[model samples]
Every structure is written in structure tokens, then in C-alpha cells.
Target chain A: MRILLTSVFVDDQAKALHFYTEVLGFVKKHDVPVGEKDRWLTVVSPEEPGGTELLLEPLGHPAARTYRDALVEDGIPLAQFTVDDVWAEYERLRGLGVRFTQEPLEAGPVTTAVLDDTCGNLIQIATQPE
Target chain B: MADDLFKALADPTRRTIIDELAEQSGQTLFEICSRLSMKHRLGISRQAVSQHLAVLEAAGLVETRREGRYKFHDLNTAPLRLIVERWLVPRTSEPEENTP
Candidate 1:
């Protein structure tokens, strides 16, 4: 079996769609209305449009909210995404008014940076070691 | 399955437990608790570890068997492999040589 989808709980689906697609450069892959206010929304990396999808699931469950808040409070990233260049990505994201909890740092062979997704999640962007 | 797996992995403690099981599978609850405390310095109770294992088992990331009086847990990495093959492997392969 293959992983068709994974999800990151978001506070608002519409806000998440805007930030993930418009700012983060992912393409909207699916958006089907699921409930009265929430939809089965998902996005894919621009570079791999047909690849695995990241579902922007609603944070309506009480457990989800608690889990997300605890991670954010502890300064831990909820999810990590690989980038071609962490520094360049950091600069580009900062230019777009994105708030970063940690700036780009080279540790060992890889470089990484963490930024708030503005949807109750801290997402990490990293570059694989050469 | 995806939701359950992700939720299981969401907690750092559960992740660490999985890491331990990955390093050496077929460990009993007592062994797991001891390893967590000795190696990871996590002083979580045996009851707590059992609950975490239950979550992991429900996620299809862990399998358990009862042998006599001992219940042994083993890591089922199939789910994680599916994730890596689906998204990570493809994205990391043949990246543009120079893109800024």
C-alpha cells in the first residue's frame, strides 16, 4: 500500500488554503466540501504536483487542538518538509512576512529552518545533505 | 489508517518508543520501559508505555504477541515505508541541479 495522503490540522481551512498554496508554493490538489463549514482540502508540492497530498484537516477535535497547542508551546515543529535550499527558502519566506521560530542553521551536513505555518503548526524546512 | 498513524507519531514519547522498537524489535514491556529509561532517560511508567504501545498498535505501526507470560512488541515499518515511497523518495530524486 502507498501513502496517498497525510494531514496537518489547521485552524481554518480557507486561511490554510491561502497560506499553503499562495505563500508556501504548494498546489491545491483536492477540495471537496465535507461538512457545513469544512471541506476535504489537500495540497501538493509544486515540484511534485501528483505526489502525496498534504490534507489541511480541520482542528475541530478537542484532542487535536490540545496536541497542536502543546507542540507549539514547546517550540516543536508539527511537520517537516524538505527544500532544495534552506537558506534561499528562508529568505524567500521571510520576504513574504512569514514568522520563523528558528533561522537557517547548518548542523553537520544538512541545513534547516523552522517557521510558523500561521495555522497553529510550526513547519520545518530542510535541505538534504550533499 | 493515515490519521491513526499520524496521530500515533505526533507525540514525541510515542516516536521515541517506536525508535527503540526499531533499533531492537520483539522487546517485552519491561524491557521497553527499562530501555526508555536507560537509553532515552525517559522515566515514564510501564503503564504509560503500554498505553503508547496500544496507540501504535492501533495505527498498524506495531504488532504484539503473547508468548507464555510475556507480551512482546515488534515494529511494523510497512506503513512508514509507504509514506517514504509515496512522497519523500520521489521529491528527493533527481532534484534540479541549480535552482534559486
Candidate 2:
């Protein structure tokens, strides 16, 4: 019944790890070898280590590439992360050379911004009303 | 070309799309759709929005650009110049009629 994990298809696990951990400030939660060239890598927010885990699943299926590419082309984010302040996070990420497809926009009660994940996906960060 | 421009601007939804694009150029189709639904309360489908963009593209009011793996939609008001030139400019020059 509980949502334990979610996934995003990454083009490269190594690069995704660096971006997710070093840049986006997530900590590695799991890194088990799956096969000869693949690993079951996952990362969790530093704020919530026991919370939901984000699996940086590899782009194994050919269809995943087409799907990701089409979504990226149209600036559709595969996943969304909640942030305390979208504008602050957007500025911080942009300072680190992260390219944003959409800037921070206030729509009704929520504010959001979209950034390129560099691992072939767009990620949206938002701040929702409490 | 003018027919296409006028037709593109004739719809309320398309005009709202223009208004959003004018606020910020170079947006993705997803962003545009998000704005329409979230900001403007437009509940149209993505396919319908895409079709509207195609109509706007044909009218030169919108231009799309490819940047690496991403494609962005940019608003181009150049075609709107035809509207000003077609009617507004001529009326301004004929002010002598009212001077009498």
C-alpha cells in the first residue's frame, strides 16, 4: 500500500550518481550489482534517509530511449521533487551550471521549475502550499 | 499568410497561448500546456494544444528551435507587424481628415 520506491531511467549510472549525490545533494542509498554492466543504484534525500528511494534505473530497453527523448524534446519532466523554496533551489542549481527548461513560475498555490537532469531527463522541482 | 495569421489569432485559446508566450518566450510544449491549465484554467488535451501550436507556427506567430536534445517554442511578433502596417499606419497618416 505504501509507495516505497520510484525510478527514473538514466543513460549512465555513474554520471547519474554524481549528479544525484554531488550536485543535487542526495545520498547514495543502494548500489548493488545487477549484471555484468549494470547496477541497482538508488539515492535518497539527505533530509529523509528512511523515506522513499529513487532508483536511477539504467536505460536498458530501447523503448525507454525513445520515450525519454520525446519527453525531453517537449520539456516534460519524468519526476518531480518537492522543495521548500523553488526559487532558491532554482538559483542554487543554476549557479552550479544546471540548465533549466522552465524557470520558477507561480501557478495558483504552487511554484515550480524544471531542469535538465543531464542523464537524459527533465526533473521538476516544486514548492506546494501547506 | 495574413489569413493564416488572423485565423491563428481568431481563437480564444490560441490568443491565451500567445499571451503566455509573450510573457516569456522560449517555452516547451509541456510548459505551455501547464500554463494553460494551471494558470489559465484551460483543460484542453496535449494533442489539442499541439495542434494549436502548429496553427500558430504556420502563421509565423510562433517559432520553434532545436537546442541539442530539446525543442523550445519561441514567440515571434514579426508577423503581427502586418496588422500594424495594414491598418494602423494608414489611419495615423490620414489624421488631416480629423484636423478640419
Once fitted onto the true fold, the runs of candidate 2 whose alpha carbons sit more than 4 angstroms away are: B91-100
lDDT of 2 by residue, A11-107 (tens): 9999999999998999999999998999999999999999999999999999999999999999999999999999999999999999999999898
RMSD of each: 21.1, 4.3
Show the lowest summed lDDT stretch of 10 residues, model 2 chain A: A121-130
Q: How would you encode candidate 2's per-residue C-alpha lDDT over B1-100 as one tens digit per residue?
A: 8788889999999999999999999999999999999999999999999999999999999999999988899999999987877667855454332112
DockQ for all candidate structures vs. native:
0.02, 0.82
lDDT of 1 by residue, A1-130 (tens): 9989999999989999999999999999999998688899999998998899999999889999888776565345778899999999999999999977656655456676778888888887888767
Q: What is the Å distance of residue B38 in model 1 from its true position?
A: 21
Candidate 2 residue A85 C-alpha distance from true site, Å = 0.6
